[model samples]
Target: MSEPAEDPQELAALRNEIDEVEREVVRTVDLGPRAVVIAAAVFVLIVGLVLPWMGGANGLEVLLGQHEAVGKASWVPRLFATTSIGFGVLGSALAIITRRWALTWVCALGGWFASVDGVLAIWSRQSSAGPGASAPGIGLIIAEIATVVIASLWFRTAWSRS
Candidate 1:
């Protein structure tokens, strides 16, 4: 004769148990030393936000469209600011804290995207400069460099797993 069907409650319990085990496995995975470097770079990026970016306006001012140059600047700088804060600082922090492989991949990809945005933002600032126009601020440059470093480190960490 054929075997009786399994109990529904038992099957649900088994599924929950399996999920817990999977989560434990993911939690135990190490991201190696690069995670520390990523954290430091994120910190640098945060510092960059408070420094002057355009027309003596800080990164936060630029992002918020409160800077005088914001009216003249293209969308590149604004976009860079969003991604840098969103992916570089927040996303990276979450991934580092959780140490989840999927989150790492997400941060890695987002970091690369933000890095490209950083380059374009710098280029836009330079290209748009005119007589008596203020040059790109030190903070912007520092933030861009930090973004690149963070992206590269995240890529290395994510790729190392595979």
Candidate 2:
């Protein structure tokens, strides 16, 4: 004859344990990307403001190219870049201050925008057969990607313990 089945309480306890484990796994898998994206967004914000005003070898100028001819950079492009930078800085600050995930998401979106900007800059160089043809600023793209991956993994691992 077969042995008696596990008690209902024991079975339920085992199920709960399994559920807990699954939750931890899910949390671990998600944290790294979130953190990376947020950090990247903050970086973008800083570049956005300081680059336009200061105009130097910083990430902004490097990524978007200098506007040696202010006339060459029209109002629309300038407006957009300025807006993005301001938003990035504000959103990131809010997130950091409040420790709110929603704010973090805003920061991530800005990061996404920054990443896109980087990609577009690279593309423009390729199309124009400009200096970007040599794959300049490629390092920034790699760094951003690396940031995303590392942050995601770190977030996942840290949250898993909770």
Candidate 3:
């Protein structure tokens, strides 16, 4: 007589699927130019945080403490800082790593919107400021540029995937 079956067809299929998933986890694929651009975007966004975003207060200072906001610092800088890093950079990176197509698009769009907001916010702040107020600092400018690049890269990578 044949030996008893250890598992039913359904169970065997499930086991096979689990093994396949394990293998996929172990295997690596080339992320290539897309990854490089993504990394640079993230790096640029991060670096912008440390640089001055306004007359004296930097992105980091605006986010961490309100002490630097002694003058008429608007909330635009803080809002942009959080969204740019939290959603634009981090969300896109995570979606790329997991290879989630839908998520990639979401991140790309969100990042783009956030980047636009950052740019507009800076302009709004500058326009609203009293005469002689300093212009938007270097950090805001760099972060905005990086966020735009990040959005573009994400879309490019997603579309390029076959």
Candidate 4:
């Protein structure tokens, strides 16, 4: 077969087209990781907020009682519930905006702390326990521990992704 003559203009136009295609591919590739990270972060944040509102209040107080005295009478329960809901909402907001590993670390530590406290609460709720023990028994304790662990693990994994 005889070879056709190549035009300089044609060669330059083809090069430009290839360069644009390469640029688009590179841009898309770069966004892939970022998109994954953002989605994971959003998911973690949503769970963090939702967990407390949906039967998480009791578990949260159980967790808190381990570290400090919870009166569990009247306003005391309400106070702790509100606090948990507030923090959960705030933490979700933080996770959405920040990419730093430190924030993720904070979330992990907080989860662990809540879980440990929850165990202590179960201990306090025994039949022989004092009146101050308020509500929640061994069953709630087990649930809270599981929830905290799961949340912590999820946050940790999300943090590590980036």
Largest lDDT belongs to which candidate? 1
Q: Of models 3 and 4, which has the larger lDDT?
A: 3
Ranking by lDDT: 1, 3, 2, 4
- Who wins the TM-score comparison? 1
Worst 10 residues of 2 by lDDT: 49-58
The residue-by-residue lDDT of candidate 1 on 1-162, one tens digit each, is 999999999999999999999878865448778778888999999999889887888889888988666775547888999999988999998998888877777887998899899889888888885653566788989999998888888777777763
User: How well does each candidate superpose onto the true structure, as a TM-score?
Assistant: 0.81, 0.39, 0.73, 0.40
Error of 2 at 96 (Å): 1.2
Give the alpha carbon lDDT tens digit for every residue of 27-113 in model 2.
332344554555664564454444332122334444364645222332333433443454445654555555544444455555556
In order, the Cα lDDT scores of the candidates are: 0.84, 0.46, 0.75, 0.45
lDDT for position 134 in model 2: 31
Worst 10 residues of 3 by lDDT: 64-73
RMSD in angstroms, candidate 2?
9.5
lDDT, model 3, position 109: 82
TM value for model 4: 0.40
The pairs that clash in candidate 4 are none
lDDT of 4 by residue, 55-110 (tens): 23433543354324344432323332333333333443464455434555555565
**Candidate 3, superposed: residue stretches over 4 Å from native:** 1-30, 70-73
Number of residue pairs clashing in candidate 4, backbone atoms closer than 3 angstroms, sequence gap of 3 or more or interchain: 0
The order by descending TM-score is 1, 3, 4, 2
